[model samples]
Structure formats: structure tokens, C-alpha cells
Target chain A: MSHTLHREGRRRDLRGEFIVMSMAAKGINDAGAGPKLRRFLRIARKHGAVSVSDVKSVMHAVFTDIGAVESVLRDLRRARLGLSVTVTGLVAPIHRACCRSEVAEEPHTVAHSLGVWGNRRRLPSETVLSVMTMCGHSLVSVPLVEQAVASVRAGVCSPRAAAVKLAEPCVCGIFNVDRAARLIARLARSGKRR
Target chain B: MVQISKSKCVCCHRCALFCPVAAIRSGRDGASWIDEAICVECGVCVRNGCLSGAIRRRRSPWPRSVRALFSDPVTKHRSTGVPGRGTAESKTNDVTNRIQPGQVGLNVELGRPGVGTSFHQVQQVTRRMAKAGAGFEEQNPLTHLMSDRRRGVFPRELWPERVLSVVVEASLPLEELAGVLKELRAVERKIGTVFSVSVYCRWADRRRMLALVDRRRLLPQAKVNVGLGRARRQR
Candidate 1:
């Protein structure tokens, strides 16, 4: 249940959002995976992962920079812990990162979201949708995102601070605070221009 | 599944603003309460926490407890032992080989973060897919609740259960992609909530499946399983 997929935004904006999930399958390898998984989180944290979840089977982390993600991926490859690692983000950069790390094994599978299909009218504004969808499970509410944008626009809070507040709602710890700050800033600027 | 403690509540109404579905309501005096019928039991109001320590989660009964199972990420589904709404296979397609070269896995995800869905709405999409000759995945939690897999019907008692979102999983031969999309479009009008479609297939067929979907609606981001895990089944 990776919420990392189906994140909506422009390619340029999405370049700032990347999520990595490392899993030890229940039957195949979950036994005694605690230490290895902890190590995975450490590597992610060392490389400046904005958020990290230590959940055994569904461990994952989010990063805003391609360099950090590539470094973590490279470290995982070197570990050879035999865990299944999946990265979600823009296709080109992800492929480039995987290849650079020498983890781009052949016969890979690609899953694409055919965006929201029904009741488009019920969705929030495009900018709000972009930020909230980052949380995947929708823990980040529409009002909270709107409030953050307003706070930034009114100069009540900095984009970085608002982004941290926005990240508090996502329990999975996959929300990228850096990317969120950039998006919140964009929304605030757009609102001012309007 | 959660309520505002009147004794502890300072009438701040902070939780109301953070509710995804607007299930939390505030009075003119700033008193607040959760609308049980509207709550999906996602625990977002509580997870975000109440500043006054006013939020409390009450024990939910059988069918009602289903909400947390499907909506709460930490609550593991007893049916599948998987922690999220969908199965692990959906995310680890390459590792499991669950969706093979000759078949297409269709994920009809109903509901969004703000707009939750009832089980009855999910049945609408499942019935449509079943009629289109799609076979539901056996390990999928949604499929485990089906009272009649052949017709994709859920028990009458379960119709009212709500969740933040759910993925109705099913698969069919690669040749039936067009027919299934047509059926999905038909049901899309009747389904009250918004949902997204995800198609999973072998890496070799990515372009083939992409060619069939309307390019305008595809999101910019996509998930690629880089084959890091040892395949369970040999190709």
C-alpha cells in the first residue's frame, strides 16, 4: 500500500518529490528483519530523508533531492540485504538514479496512475490537490493545506515552518517537507498574483 | 470512532479544520463533536492530536470497526494481514509476479482523502468488473468481504460501512483491457466519489498499456519496481 504513487504535479515540480520503500516480504524474509530495516532507516536519515517510517514490512522514506535518493539507493545495493526496494517519482530521473546506482535491474515493472477518473468536481483546487495527494492516504486534509497556503501568503509563517506543520498529519512519514515548502510557496505566490 | 471530550475541549475547534471529510462540526459557541455517520474512522483528527487533549477514540463494533481496518494505515486488516487498504502485491508487482505478462491487473480505487466511500459504492464498481469477466484477486481484503464473488456482491449488512478509500482489485487477459475500460467509464458516472485507475503489467507491456489509456488523464508520476527483489516465480 504505497501512497507514493499517483502523486500529481508538473514534471519540474515532481522532480523535488521522491519516495523509497524497502520491504522484507512476510514469508520470504520478514523473520529477523528488524536490524536490517533499522539500518535502512539510518542510511535514509543520514542522507537527509525528510521523513521515515520504521514499520517492518512497509518501511519507507521520502527525500527532496535526487542526489540523496541516489546515494541511499547505492548504499542499499551495496548492503545486498536482499530486500525489495521500490522508488516512486518522475520516470526519467528515477531511471537515471537507479542506473547510476547500478540497481536498475532488467525486467522491472512500472505502475502508472490514470489520475482521478470520476467526480472531478468534488476535488479541491489544482494546487491544493497537488499538496494533499502527497500524503497518499489523504491524512493531510484540504483545510490544513489551505490554511498553510494562507499562512504563507499572509506572512504569518514561513514556507518551511508551514511545510513542517503540513507534514505532521501524515502518519506514514512519506511526506516530503522540502517539496511541500516549495509547493506551499508557489500556492502563496499564485494567490497573491490573483 | 472518535469524539471530542466536552470536559477537556476548550472550544478551540482546531480538529474541525483538519478533518478530511469535514466530519467534525463546531457549534456557534465553538463547541465541537464528530459526526459519527460521516466519520470514516481514519483517526486523522486524533492522529493530528487535540491541543486540549479533548479527542478520544471509542471502541467501534464489528462492521463499524471495518472502517479503521481499511482507512487506518497502522491497523492491519485481519482478512489479509496487510497493513493498508490494498494488498502488498499491488505495490510489489515485479517481486511477486502477481500480474504476469499475459494479464493486466486493474486497480479501481474508489474515494479520495476528503471524499470517503461506502461499501455499497465499492460494490457498484466490483459488480461492473465482475460482469466484464474480471476475476478478483483472492488475497485482496476487498475480495475477502465479497458475499458473492461471482456477482461481486457484498452482504446487505456491510453496505453501510465506510472507509477513507479502497482499491477493488481484479485481473483479466491482456486482450480485455478495452472492454474493462469501457465498463469502468459506465460505472464512473454512477459512483458518487472520485477514484483513480492504476494498471499493472510486465515491464515489456508498459508501452502497450500506456497506448490504450487516454494520455490527458495520466499523472506525471509513475511507480517503477526496479526488480531489486528476487522474483518468487521464474520467468
Candidate 2:
């Protein structure tokens, strides 16, 4: 028998675990068993390949194969929404997983206390952090990047200084500071605030 | 396959209760049996749901090693001897010297959620990049599959193998960025599933990329990562 697909319009699932209530109340089960919540999130991120950051919209279907996933992705594109089903995975229905530890920001290993971690005044704000953390690898957050874009746009920061500032956060060297500078320049000048 | 030990399984069916793909079934004896065909080896049951430590992974032979490759975070990739996905290509480039000054590395990922790649999508890329004289990063998982790094070919035996995602990594001259983008787009419609591409370059290289991106309308979805953790040239 083919798998049943469930469609959930974009909901901000930061942890990717919240369950659909109607299905849960009906005992969302496959065969005789159900899917666990943690399993759902894992399958979703690894399989769906949708940027979990500011996803804006999502089309979730379970028990579906590549053909079905592809169809839904095509449908979303047809709807003029910017979404692509890059990956797809399974998610079970039962809850009981506290998975925050699995993907928490790396700051936890160094800071002895949650308070200390939160008090990291040097860290970027929720607005910027929300934007920066979308990369998942944690190499892209540079205060100098935003500052450099603004400065370079205003002729206040030299291009050289801007490059240094942009490169500062890239310890892993994967973060493309160069492309970002250009985007930032455009965004800053346009006042787009991205 | 994910096995639920008969001796250990309580028949609570808790572990199988929420199987996303219906891979688990109640046996005649009330024990849990996971269908090999349906199982994606996601490990969610063993990690979070198993209460009696009853669920265990049977040793995956040769090609299924692909599953273990992406599933088990600690399993060191045989080809590169690096643990967990591309020597942390994005995580350790500064230390590894995989990326260099005036150059950028492009990491392309091809993936499925449960069912994995058959090495077809990956081969398309390796062939193209190798043809371009680009070098695949030694520590990357996809490079591990390459029997000929220069040809971007995986071992013939691995052609049917599957995994969650494969990162094919290559470093190139910054000027080749557009060409790389073009190459990827050429193969975009050929694959069965979807993918993402990341270009790793220096801060000084952003303007040129921006120009290319604007002209070509490529990588509008790509996220820019500035390594905030790196030692600053200024500070």
C-alpha cells in the first residue's frame, strides 16, 4: 500500500517537533504503531532539506515517497511560493523527547552556566542571531558584517576594513564573507534590512 | 535494519507505536519486527524511543555502510578517516587548509529523507568538477566514494548505494564561481531529488560573487556564514 501524505502549511517549528492535533487525537499510526516526536524532527531536517530558518512556508507529508514529495514540491512552486523539497524523512507521532541538547549552540560547552551563556553581550541580537543561526554551521555571525555593509555603503568603513570585519567571524573559513559583503552593501543601500 | 530484541522487548509496542514509515509491525508473538525494505535506518527508535535498550542495529555490510556513514555520527568515514561528514568541511577549513587564499570551495549536497542516493547525483557532480581540474577535498564523504578523484568517479560497486545526503566538495579559483554555478544548474533538472550548494570563499571575494549572483540570479537562497569564532586579523 502507498503511504499517506499529510500537508502542514508553514508553521514555525523551531525544534521541528510539534504534532498535528487532529491526527494525534485520532492516534496517528502507521500500521499498528505510531511515530515518535524526536524521530519526526530528525527525519524532517535530515530528509526535508528545507531551510529550518525563516521557512515562511512548508508542505509536510508523511508516508510519502520521492514521487509524492516531488509532486508536492512542484505544487508549492506552482503556488508561487519559494520552496523546494530538497530532502524528505520520516517522523513518528508519539512525544517524549527533549532534544534541545542535540542541536544547541556550541556556547554551552564553554560556559559553565546558562546565565553566563545568555549574558554573552558580545553575541548578536535575536534579529541578527535568527538570521545568522540559519547557517547551522555557526561560522557566519559577524557584527562587523552588518557594520561593514553600512559603513561601506556610507563610505565610513574602508573596503579593506570591511573585509577584515566580515572575515573575523569565519574561523572555519566556510562563511563566504565576500559574497555577503556585496549582498550586505545592496541590502543596506536598499534599506532592505536583511 | 533496526532490531527489537525479543528477550528485551516488553511488547509495549512503544518503540514501534510511532514509526513514521510503518516499518515496524507486531509479530505473531507480539514482538516487534522492522521490515528491512521500509526501514531507512534513521536511528530515531534506538536513540529516543527504546526504553529497554532492546533496539539495536545489525552490522551493515558493504553498501549499507552508506547508511551508517550518514546515520552514526561517530562512525569515521573509511575513505577520509574523518568522523562525521566532511571533516567538518565547514567547521575546520581554517585548520585543514582545504580552502586557500583567493580561492573558494563549493560543497554540493544531494539527498533524500528516508530513501537515499544511488550515487547517480553525486557522480554527475564529480564528473563535472573533475573535468574542470578541480580537486575534491580529501576529507569529504563524497571524495571517499571516488575511485578516481580526478575523474570524479565513485567505485562501481557503490553506484546503487544509498545514504541520507552526500557532500561533494571541490575548491576552485574564485573566477570559476560562475562556471561552477552553471555546472550545477545544468545537472539540477537531471536528478530525482533536490539539493543545495554552498560556496566557500574569502571576505574579499564577496563583491564578485554578488555580481555573478545578481547577473545569473543564482543562490538567492544560500546563507552567508561569517566565521565569528575565528581569530581576527584586527583583534
Candidate 3:
């Protein structure tokens, strides 16, 4: 899920983005991963995670709220399931949240994207990139984002509904619909102003 | 791996808009067809679900099947036993310590932001990174494609294959990062598709590494392993 690391947006625009992924070493710890992950999902939902991707070896829960991330981290730390939990988001806030959770350690490491490079001249606007990058696999295409914006500008569908449509192709299940809705609404408003 | 069923296609041409690479087009018969040459097999058209049931996914033979393995998240690469274009790089580093201090893990992601890429484009990068003295990560899915790791060469037969994205994972000493970025920039114009550069490093060494990279070039946000895991890497 390293691709999830490069989501585009301003600091405020990305405030609602936080993805927590849990995985166990394939043969060694994966024996009872199912039940441990079920409990992880339960705790995530309880803390207001917006979406959850439940699979056999790897699972992810996305949250739009930092408080939820902090709470989940604190709870998971207490649970001590021995599973590796990784969080993808802004470094400072994640560091601050980890500090608050009293993990007693700074972030172990971080992956920072140098943003998009090479032949980016014809790429979509930053707004579109912000929304499309949510699906790290690029399943959310530029045309789809434009279609969503057009639908919202034409009043053919609600922003939330259009956001849901845009989110359909992302199989990673990491696409944050709530944040996409907000960004889609913002994109529509900008298009209208233009 | 996915194709538009000629008989079922209504030629509404709507599905063409959903294709990231613009691979779908209307032929002389006024029916939508996918250009196999350009289709990255991302399955967007099929996943969108054509009301006419026009788009369908079928497994391809070996080597040709590699397209879906790299592009489709639902299709797992048997070698890595992981879905998506690459491994769980620095995301799980808190416990794994895959990237140790004084070292930087660089992921050169080709064919992103809706512009798909072929393996040949990926080789252009791997070759340059290799020349810069970077070591390729053994477990990365992209490395599995390399016919020669030292030369960053892929099998000649697979060079034409395209995918939504391919992540070239390599590592180098922290001090050499700036030079490697410069090397990538010099060759960036040669690669036909767009790609992004991501840097992974231990948190303690981030400050020094950040000093080597242009702050303006980096996205404001980042991905961090916040040390919430139970297992700690012992020095």
C-alpha cells in the first residue's frame, strides 16, 4: 500500500485522510490473522473509521478524523496483538498523534513522495489529482473525476452521489468517500466559478 | 486481460470516457473496442459494469498475463503474494526495519496520474538508478521482471507490455540521494509516460535526507509508520 502514501492535496485538504493497514508475516503469524483482524476492524469502526477493507492476510481501515487515529492507535497498543499496524498520512500530525497515544517513540520511518514528475504538463488540475490519487492504483481516472465534477456542476447528482460514483473503481478499498465528497463539491464549485 | 465484447457493445461510447489511457474507441462499425496495445488492463471498464454487459475480463496466456498482474489490484502477483504494483515498502517499517538509518529507499513509480507505462519505460529508469549505484530491492514485484539486476534489463519479450503503474524499488546511501535524483531528472524527459519519485527513510534520518531534496518538489503530505506496532527492531 506504499502507493497510498502519495495522495495529493494541501494540508487542510488532506486533514480528513488517514489510512491504517495491518498485516502479519505470511506463514509465521498469519495462522490466526482472521480473528485478530476482525477485532481490529471492530475497534476501527468503533473509533469512526469511514471504510474498512477486510481480507485474509492484509486489512485496512480508513479514518477521516485524527482523533479516531489516535484513539485507535492507543487501543491497538493496549491490545498488543503483535500485528504490524501502519498509518499513511501527514508526518507531523501522525507523529503528534503517536506522541499523544504515548507510543514512546517517534515515527519509526516515513515515505515522502517528491510529488508527480515526468510528463506532468498535461495532467489534470491539482483538485483532480487530489481526488484521483486517493486510489493509489490510478483506477480513478482523470475523465471520471471530470465527469463527477461536470455532473455536480450541472446539478444532475449530489456531490456525495458523484463522489460515490468516482470511488467505484478503486478495488484497494482505501478511497475515502467522505473526503472525496468534500473535494468533489469543491471541484464543482470551482468549475462553476470558472 | 479485459476486452469490450463486440456483440454486446451498444457503441454508446460512454465507456471510452472511463478509460484512463484512452484505450477504448469507436471503430468503423460504430461499436466500442479496446486497443489491446494501449489497454493497461486496469479493468476500469469492466469494473464500472456496462449495463449492456459489453466489457468482460478473460485471463491471458503467460507473459501477456503480466499486464493484469501489474495493473489490476484484484490480481495478485504470485511471486510476491501481494496485490498492486509493488510491495509494502516503508509502510510497515516500524516493525520490519526494511529501511535502516543512513539508507534511503527510493520508489520510482512509472505510469501514474492516469498515464499508463510499458516495461520499456520502466527499464529506462532502472538502468539509470542502477548506474547511480543504487541496489534494487529483491522482494519488489518490479525486480522480478528484471532479466539482469545489474544492468536493470527486463526480458526482451516483456518490454512491450504496459500497465497502470510499475514501482522501481531501490536503495542507496543517504548522501548519494541528491545525485540520484539529479540522474533521474536528467533522464525524465526520455521516458514517454509520467512517473513520481518517493523517498523512504528512517524517521531519525529524515531531517538530513530532506536537506538533500528540494522541499518545493515534495508533496506537502507524507506516509509515516508511527511506531504503533508491538514489535520493535533491535539494533
List model 1 lDDT by residue over A99-192, tens digit each. 8989874537777888887788888887788788888888888888888999999999999999999988787777878888988999999883
**Cα lDDT tens digits for candidate 2, A45-148:** 55443212211011222322333333333333333211112221222111011122111121100000001011123344333333233222322323334555
Give the candidates in order of lDDT, highest first: 3, 1, 2
* DockQ of each candidate relative to the true complex: 0.60, 0.02, 0.57
Docking class of 2: incorrect
CAPRI docking class of candidate 3: medium
Better of 2 and 3 by DockQ: 3
Residue range B1-235, candidate 2, lDDT tens digits: 5688889988877556334334678899998878775564656567544678889987677776676565433345464455456533333232233456667776665552222345766787668777766778775666766778878888777776555456677777877767766766666556664444555554345445455543332311222111211221221
Q: Residue B158, candidate 3: how far off, in angstroms?
A: 1.8
- 10 residues in a row with least lDDT, candidate 1 chain A: A24-33
Error of 2 at A117 (Å): 36
Fraction of the reference Cα-Cα interface contacts (below 8 Å) that each candidate reproduces: 0.71, 0.00, 0.72
Tens digits of per-residue lDDT, candidate 3, A1-194, equal: 36677788888878778899887644345556678888888889999888888643577889988889999999988887777777888777888888899864677877888987888776778888889989878888787888888999899999999988888888768898988999899988877321
lDDT of each: 0.80, 0.43, 0.81
